[model samples]
Target: MPYENPAALRITSPGLCRDATFSSKHALHLLSWNIAGWSAKQKNLDLIAHLNKSDIIFVQEMWSTQNLTLDGFSITCLPATPSLPKSKGRPKGGLALLISTSTSARIKSLSSCNNIAMGVLLSYNTISFLLINVYIPPYSSRVLTDQAWEDLDRYITDLEAQSPRALLIIMGDFNARIGPNNDALFASNLWGGEVIDHYSSIYGRISKDSRINYGGICLTRLIGSRNLIMLNGLNQVDPCAEYTYISGQGSSVIDYALISQHLLKTILKFTVGNRQDSDHLPLTLSICLPERGRLTFAHNQMANPLHYTHKRTFWSPLVASNVALFLTSPSGLAIKEKITNATNPFSVLTDYDTLISKLKMSLMLPSPSHRAINRTGLPRWFDKDCLDVKRQLRQTYLHYRLQNANTLPPEYFIIKKKYKSMIVTKKRQAVHEGWKALIHASRTKNSKSFWELVSGSMRPSNLAPCHISSHT
Candidate 1:
């Protein structure tokens, strides 16, 4: 159970992951992460900044008693009611939801369940969604607790009872080890009503674990009855069903994203953060709303979360000596052309960070290039076969680790090496074809396809709003 460093887990531009592409403008992004303890420290702040691309963020275990604040977001924090006799210290069992203010999103009702779950109705863009964040207490599968089983059912009932019905988006750390999607695991009459397929429609989802716990059993049955799909392993995009929490005790995918089948189309890809500043990883679901989706934006250019973004400077050693010297010098760090922090080029300015941003754009805008590069997260050439292999590799790897054997079974290496080699060969052929297409496009003066492929390969698509100018 080796813990992967959060830094090594950071997802960067292009290349590997199939779901690392897409824009936030045409899509709604929901990110769920357990921060353990929320604070104002630099690492937490940096983590928050990195996650700013998400439109809706659900956080669990806030562990804070005071109200929390974040720019560009409307935050709601819910802390479990403590015992009457011991209510004087640090608050425990906290949950939070952060919605981007840019959306015409309004919170209608705030409610909770079994002191372990809470939800709010979100109305925006003419669509209504009941958003629930849950943090279930640990309970043994052998001795399932009544509270753990009934909390969600009761909460959903109360929230759905609101005047108009809304779609459901429930997510959080359930501490449930639902190994995989097995029809046998669920009782035939789990919910009294027969649900066709029992599993909601999901393109690619796979779970690696085979260990089903008390919470997992309850959750599986509950979602089965309600027609909600658990968006994690047991599928393709995240085939290995990456473990959310890892430790000496071993790892499992305890945290999850539960959503109604209706919201499936808009989601180009579903991803789980490989690392974060917590024991659990982050899960992000990107939903592409229609282009005409009613999103509120300030007339002020700066107020738009879209239309602009900050890209880190990529230092280059190939540039001319004089040009490189100036770029590396104290003066280059200043947007107002005044040298202040040569030690830190990323220092924020007080036009509340806007004035300096404009000045920097004016000073360092890139050379002109083609436009029309829409990042849709789907790789045009990556077909279903490639996806299947990735799914298998991940599942196998997880199984190997969990076995905890000193030596792999016979023929394991031979099979592993064969699969790896096949993937490498396929990757090389794909890259060659891509470059060939790029060259042909350039030769034929077909700029649209050329830039699309180029930009797609160069950087991962950001959820932040961005626009390319006519000048560049």
Candidate 2:
């Protein structure tokens, strides 16, 4: 059965999932990777570790693998539509999105064209955006015809037309190489001249080795028409200058993340991962989102006998007075006569639904407090002294970086070493103090205090310890 509620569709981690709330101060980390049919059993742990850092992830070519679940993520997979034509002996293409459990983002599935593409409307607080993940099949004279390209272009155009105000973010393996020189805004030093020429020669040049092939031309035109910014092209220097995809034919940059112009200022960083787990490396982006106010309600204590008694006592007198007033009213004469003349217990009883409605209308329950308790138990070592030291450390590091550019001064490293040592010493001291207090409490036979100390000393787990056996 289809879920009627959007929240009902969500699956939470079994244990130790953080209470996710929207915050404007922090940046949202997004990652996209073409895993090239992630089927290696041995690399599962490595892949999970890499994905843990990002809040949202888009993976392409996730072929043939089911039951691929992570500890702190909700996974949604879309496999290639069988109706689409496939090449003989070619592996089926698939895509997946892994959203962090510790995110306040609400996601609703949007209409998409089969498995070639998937779209989702994401809302975080007041901000809403449309994210489309697409995997354009490699151009082939025999297998992928012009019809495929036409379908993809049409889909994109329709998506834009539907949500004109939405901040659009299109990320995937486009199978299109957009050379640095094609967009004059990109500096020459960003990409090597030889690399551009090599791709141009292989793919056929459109305009002097700067733009290549029909795919590249289509993508460039799309970017221009949409007023979108190519994150890779905006790079001043290529952090990962090596090609994204490597094969017998050689390397090329086929993966891309094109976002709306409004998001350019919010971009904190962009980089391509150097991990060799797949032929294509991961592309990571960090962007700051608008801040939102956190709302939390105090835990309801109505289940407790003492709490129930207190509530009953507080409302009983008021309820009795209201009931008496109702009985004396002119309209209440019919009800009063009916109650007085009732023979059976059932005759005297009011309808359960109507009784509840009346009680709710007459009775006023206390509102739950909005103030949230601080659950993060910082160690005693994290005191004002430690805070002062941290401030000094930050200032020193910033000063050194500003003066020396990318190079760290020798004094900065010396101070960093000293800072690390100080933290270690303070932490050890705090541990010793905690142990001493625990021992004293135990010796004194203060059971409540001992238990409190023990519970307080324990650290909160961030990930579920056990693995989920079922995927669906």
Candidate 3:
């Protein structure tokens, strides 16, 4: 049974007090991950890195934690209900969605079934869409009960009844193993009035290694009935590496992102994350929107000319080298002769704004080409040693893979264990250092630095304020 408590769901608005407007240019990048019960003690730097690249994030298995606040994204989370005895020991079956602050997408409504599933109705401009995040627990019987299917069927039916035209995106850890192998069985049971064997043969069989769990059958029936398409089917970029969950037992593609049939063409890419922060890997979906615009940032803006001028000492040698090369070129020689032979020095001088401009022109370094100040600064704890350690870890992993084709050597495991320990140590040190800096700023009452630290810690949301309500 799903959680029945209405208070289990909480709507959070991070920074914005108004709604944001989105268009075609603002492509939506969605990331889904099962964090296995995220806690404050876990290092979120890698997770934050992924969040920075995404417009919206859907997370599952998020247990109750004190640090619910994430910088720039408004979070809506639904905890497991106490009413469900199944949620006893595994209180981590919570679901949450994080929407970028800058997006114009506004939450129109929210709905949840405790730890089973959560839904958010979002609107951009006049276009509305339903985003559902779900987590179906693994059944010991390897079969989905009739009630499970009924619950899903009713929830989706209600959504369709509420807004028939709204686009639908259903994503998260379904704990379902879906592929071509079980198409015949799924189609025969749920897809009636059609030639089951013919449809199954057309879909073809998935890789032999991919298993078909009972939940997968339920998902197939749901999508087939609704004319929905799974994003996994569109993943032609890398077919073999489609699994989303891996453990000591092995790997299986259980996580998914499904969309309405009409929105299939909008999908640009679907792939899984290589980094492992949890047992389940993250899945990403990039979709082109109907509107168009570049994603701009304050840090990406061009630096002031004065700032460059003050740092001339650093670039002087490189500039001189470039100028020397230019002087020997045909175009540079022609300009030099023209300047020397010109009747009026003032006229030649007028053609060039300043010495820096002339030098820049000669160096072929336009303002746009010059490197800008890094607006997105690194975390306070991220130091050179940490970076070096990460590089070494990658190198070691690469070497191990190259040496041991398909086999895992005992030595390889030892190397991996050693590096993992070193990484954990470094991460702890960095977090400690970051907290120390924050404490110092607060104690000193340095408002600017303190707020900057706060803002930097969590990217501020750029979206307008909107309300969220969860229907149990």
Which one wins on lDDT? 1
Which candidate gets the maximum TM-score versus the true structure?
3
Shift in Å, residue 401, candidate 1: 13
- Candidate 2 wrong stretches, greater than 4 Å: 1-24, 41-43, 65-68, 81-90, 142-146, 183-211, 237-242, 293-472
Q: Provide the lDDT at 145 for model 2.
A: 33
Alpha carbon lDDT at 344, candidate 1: 40
- TM per candidate comes to 0.55, 0.50, 0.57
RMSD to native, candidate 3: 16.0
lDDT of 1 by residue, 1-472 (tens): 0221232224231112233232345667789987776642212334656667787888888776544455556666675444345555555677877776555455554756755777767765546788898888686544455566676787687788873468888889988776554543343343346453534322233465556666676776677677676668523335546667744355677898887766643455677674424557788887655444534332123322332234444444533444545555565544334434334432332222434333343344232323221132223333456456645645654565567443334444444455556656766787798789899999999998888878856532222336989999
Q: Report lDDT (Cα) of residue 361, candidate 1.
A: 35
**lDDT for each of the candidates?**
0.59, 0.56, 0.58
Across 1-472, the per-residue lDDT of candidate 2 in tens digits comes to: 1211232124131111123432336677889988876543223444566788898888888764242344445555676433235432434677876666445465555666666777766665556667778787776652363556566667777876877776888888888765534434122343333233222212111111233444665565466556676666343313333345644344567778788866655666776665544667688887667655111111121122221111222557767887666657664656667767877664454322223334443564332222111122233465566556656655764574345333334654455456657777977887788789889999999998788777754422212245567974
Q: Which parts of model 1 have CA positions greater than 4 angstroms off?
A: 1-25, 40-43, 80-84, 88-90, 140-144, 183-205, 296-472
The CA root-mean-square deviation of candidate 1, after full C-alpha superposition on the true structure, stands at 20.4
lDDT of 3 by residue, 264-373 (tens): 55555676665545667788887666542322212112122111121123356777888888777776676676767778654365333223234544553322211111
